[model samples]
Target chain A: MHELGIVFYIIRDVKAAAAENSVQRISAVVMNIGEVSTVVPEYLTDCWRWAADKEPLLKGSELKINMIPAVTQCQDCGQEYETVKYGKTCPHCGSGNTFLLKGNEVEIKEIEVPNN
Target chain B: MDKVRVIEIKKSVFAENEQDANALRQELKDRGVYLLNLMSAPGSGKTTTLIKTINLLKDKLRIAVMEADIDSDVDAVKIKEATGIQSIQLHTGGMCHLDAEMTRQGLDGLDLDGVDLVILENVGNLVCPAEFDTGAARNAMILSVPEGHDKPLKYPLMFSVCDVVVINKMDVAPYFDFDLEKCKEYIAMRNPNAKVIPICAKTGEGVEAFAQWLLEQVQTLKH
Candidate 1:
């Protein structure tokens, strides 16, 4: 349900970028999807394909996702580790006092248009 | 020609929405309106708790409710009939969450004049609603006994983002193996500052605390 909503936001931003740059058509929209962004890449592209084709400027445009690895930093031990594997508990000192360093992004990296 | 030109955006999908939410928050503050975003799973007794709390504090503060759902106005009607305050239903049009713009549109439909607090009953989902900022001054959630005490562990982001967690269905906690102490512990783990209030919305036990919390929040925000 949310994937389709996300796709709509992407299309809106892409269309705005295209219009501002005077680009006629978009070939692909690259996204930086984090491991813990809660957005599944497959669902996003599936929704993107359905929603993007409705607009003439984004017909057949591909959504390329770049997965970012999640990392967590332990405040107690001053160590960083993989968020997916260790979660809130820091592997270094077995401390639950930790915060996510990154990998929570659902960012649009760029838009690509065919060079005329 | 197979050659392409790239337009660097490097913007988060929620960036614009977050900005809008902040702007709306500023506007709400300027108008002395305290907007509370309430979220939870579908059967978490959010509406029940809300009804109880509203009745308790209605005399002290001028309040309005905006109920957001994928369809139907049942909750809105329920609130209006039960509390007799101004309540409006917002149709999300199949979206799982309500963003800042949707919240603003809902606020526009209401008569904000002389209203001190606006409570937004967000779509009942722990996942998607946690992702979007709805421009509320504060965020709260309800966790029922049947939903288990491990909800914070499962839905970490939702717990982390919430300012308060209301533990509803306390009267039935004995039958369901719902450990109130463990529930508070779990909520504390996710959010150290989140205030937890145990209540039985059915029997109207411990609802005064929630109502008091809301009253204090509205007073602080307005003053």
Candidate 2:
């Protein structure tokens, strides 16, 4: 639902970067979406296809999402576990004191431009 | 012969928004306006809680509100009728959440001349709203009793980002199976420093303490 706004942000940033690099056209934009980031990859791509094509610089550009697994570290046990599976509690020690280590990324990892 | 080249940008999609949020934070800090991004699920009594808090602190502080909704001026009207404070309704045009730029636009529409605290009642969404920073000095969320106590387990990110969690609608706790302590434990698991305040917005219970907390946060921003 909020993917369209994010898509616009991505396009803006990509356009700025493309201008800086003197790139005429971008072929694809790769995103590193985290497992728990609330950004649905399918929705993002759907929105991107609809919105990105409107921009000449991003027309026909493909949006690829790379899913990053969310991990949580338990404070008491000092062990990491899958955040999506165990949530805030540590499965290894049943400890509630835990924090996310990664997998909350909503970043653009790479941009592919047509090479001539 | 054509070749495909991939640029190793490795930049965050949220980087722009983060930068905007940080800039807005600095601007607000310079102006001595403490911004609070208030979020919650639909029907979590965010408006009621805001009204109650306004009533408690209106005399002590200059207050303003920006109500963000998909397409409704209902909340803005309600806020005006209740407190007569400066209020602006932001129509997100089908967007589920307000990013920092959108928030800055809303702030631009407001008359912040003497406003000490500006409360942004974000669109009623637990998932998307938690993901965006609205350049608020403090992030607060409301969890109603009927929403169940297991919400933190299911939506850990929302709980994790919140500075304080208000357990609203506590007046009906007798009818619901919501466990306050258990919910607090869940919140603490994700964010140990998050303060949990139990309040009934309808009855104004615990609103004074909530107001006090807000005052303290505003004071902290002053220093």
Candidate 3:
């Protein structure tokens, strides 16, 4: 699946950051997965476990996912509402002139390293 | 006695990919090539619609296509045989989707000297392709009648992010239980601004209108 490709990216970035900071062992990688993001958290972690374990620095490292709620903004009413609940229409104004404000991200929020 | 210290680094996982996508967008904008990322489920007439689109616009504008798949050059061959346009096949090596970096590499392989339009036929999958922005100026998705009308409801994110939604295989709309109006309503609910065009690539119906819309977009980019 594409999750493996994403896991590789995470590994590459984490390795680069670790080398720069002179950190030897990575303890966990935190991800900010939005509610609407296509990447399934379960599949991502499953792929991460398989790929991350192969790297010495990431062997036994944990993958933590932080779910972000999707929100939409109404251009007409200037109101913010849950994207999953209301979709493109703003519930308050009943206007179809709306756009997503957040919750489509698939980003690394933090990378944790063991300090000894 | 030893103490464990924790170092926290906040960064986006897609930062590198998004940066590459933005750079590629700027590069394409400078070159005046309007790249369109086309996505849909497998066997949804994506290639058929693309070929039809090429036939409509090949004479009006310089056009090329990059057919991406998990493997094989089947779709690429079809494009060349149908329109005689330059078609390149990108084997994703088992990946179901094309990211910005992959799209950049595919474009680099092509000779865009006089070409004003380049369409990236992304791998036939609804989920992953929608997640990654391939630096296309616009994103279009095709949904065949046989695929059913509830797809917009099932895959809300895909419908939500697209600029245009093409309902292909309209010629056979009578036989199937596909509701044209209902489908449009679903798409509108998810994406208010998305343009929905009902087309039958087999019969060339509604292809001209779609081509006109595409030309307008290309013209906008040119100016």
Candidate 1 deviation (Cα RMSD): 1.1
| Top candidate, metric DockQ | 1
Residue A112, candidate 2: Cα error in Å is: 1.6
The best candidate by TM-score is: 1
RMSD value for candidate 2: 2.0
- Please give the distance, in angstroms, between residue A38's alpha carbon in candidate 2 and its true position after superposition: 2.9
Candidate 1 lDDT tens digits, B16-103 = 8999999999999999999999999998988888888999988898999999999999999999999999999999999999999999
**Model 3: per-residue Cα lDDT at residue B161:** 87
**Any runs in candidate 3 off by more than 4 Å, and if so which?**
A68-105, B1-3
Q: Give the TM-score of candidate 1.
A: 0.98
Model 2, A3-110: lDDT tens digits are 988898899889998998999999999999999888899999999999998999999999998999999999998999999898777999998788889998988888
Per-residue lDDT of model 3, residues B57-78, tens digit only = 9999999999999998999999
> Which of the two, 1 or 3, has more lDDT?
1
Candidate 1 pairs with clashing backbones: none
Clashes of 1: 0
Clashes of each: 0, 0, 3
Q: TM-score of the candidate numbered 2?
A: 0.93
Candidate number that wins on DockQ, 2 or 3? 2
lDDT of 2 by residue, B65-144 (tens): 99999997999999999998999999999888999999999999999998899999999988888878889999999999
Whichever of 1 and 2 has more lDDT, that candidate is 1
